[model samples]
Target: MPVLRQITTCTEPSTVVIERRVRTRDRSVDYRLEVCRRHRWLASNWTGRRSAEGSGGRCGTVMDYRPYAQIVQSHADLWLRPLAANGPEDHDGDLAAALRAGFEFLTAHREPTGVAIALEHAARITEAIAAGALPLVEGQAQVLAALSAAETLDAGARGA
Candidate 1:
């Protein structure tokens, strides 16, 4: 097996790294997922290397590989839910804060060019929220749309 590429995305408490490898014989793609949460790690589709601890290796246990989109969607959902939830009177402020935090995190990990769409969407959402133009539900929809569009664009770039 030859290593291919790896991408990482992060939100507050978690960071997910997806490594894509291809088998030379059949040209099949294999996804290896690694997640870090508050300094703890969980990995899937591990390479079967044993650690000194020998408890299935560093990440604790191994799991089967999952589709790339599935992994991205799950992580996005987990991170985006709070932006959709009800909050105090300062809900819009909270939403803007959340968006800013997410944008910063994404910027730090991924290339600004790669995540330009997401950054644009986040700016729009926060601007609307600040200007009192977006209600909670509409804001959530826009966020979802933003993520969908970004994912679609990324997939297309990858020729997937």
Candidate 2:
């Protein structure tokens, strides 16, 4: 189980909740988190920081490109299929775990690049499964492949 931490930003009275869902043998147990940002200032401030830093704000870098809330919401969106099928209440634990994992990963990485990468791969894999290109039981394989691709790209860029 991933630890859940609530981090309050210094600039605003906003609380960012980090949740993580442990992976289970059941695919339905795979969870994604939803991030809700109530304050507009946070988003604007994050954008300003990214621009000032000259970092693309996408990949692991010096600054966060997307507000923490957006990152959470986006991942939730990406992981929608499972959530919808299992119902939110049924997957709350896993959702919390996934959120924690995402928060930790983004905090350590400092880049939100994984959002696009994961989203892209998720869409592709979902489509493949629907079309029978990939077996439904191989969903974990799809996730691993996506992660591997992202890591490979990151490694290649670093090597260059």
Candidate 3:
């Protein structure tokens, strides 16, 4: 194993490796593991510069270790759905529900990035509603009140 180490762990658990180098007793055994999709292979075929004289230990130099990181990213890509290009119907309760779901999802999923995403979604939905999306009725005061509350919450959060 080489004393220098590099570790990369992605949000999607995948690849991992440990490396080290040693010099002693006129000989040393350097060990390393390269893993990908349950595949394991030895890289012991390396032992020095292609045309160096005297003696030198292999595994002390850096090499292309990207294959390991690529494995981890492969798993992360599977976890998220691609946003649709056409998006939801421009004028339907279904569109409201979908927009509401996105706002809800953004709030419930508290990432370090914060809940700013939810506020943006909320604003977009409100804008759509104001543009004669779902016709407002005199008796829709209840709905408007609820929307006001949600807006106030989002505004307070932004100020905080």
The estimated TM-scores of all candidates read 0.32, 0.25, 0.24
Which order, best to worst by lDDT? 1, 2, 3
lDDT (Cα, tens digit) per residue for candidate 2, span 72-157: 34335433333223212344534333533443444454655554355456546655765787786575345444533443344344
Clashing pairs in 1: none
lDDT value, residue 139 of candidate 1 = 67
Q: Please, what is the whole-model Cα lDDT of each candidate in the order they appear?
A: 0.42, 0.36, 0.32
Provide the clashing-pair count of each candidate structure: 0, 9, 5
lDDT of 1 by residue, 25-141 (tens): 654535444444432333333333322231222221112243433433343443334332322123443544554455555566666544445645755775785688998556655
For model 1, the superposed segments whose C-alpha errors exceed 4 Å read 1-115
Winner of 1 and 3 under lDDT: 1
TM-score of candidate 1 to 2 decimals:
0.32
CA shift of 85, model 2, Å: 20
lDDT of 3 at 99: 41
TM-score (C-alpha) between model 3 and the true structure: 0.24
TM-score (C-alpha, index-matched) for candidate 2: 0.25
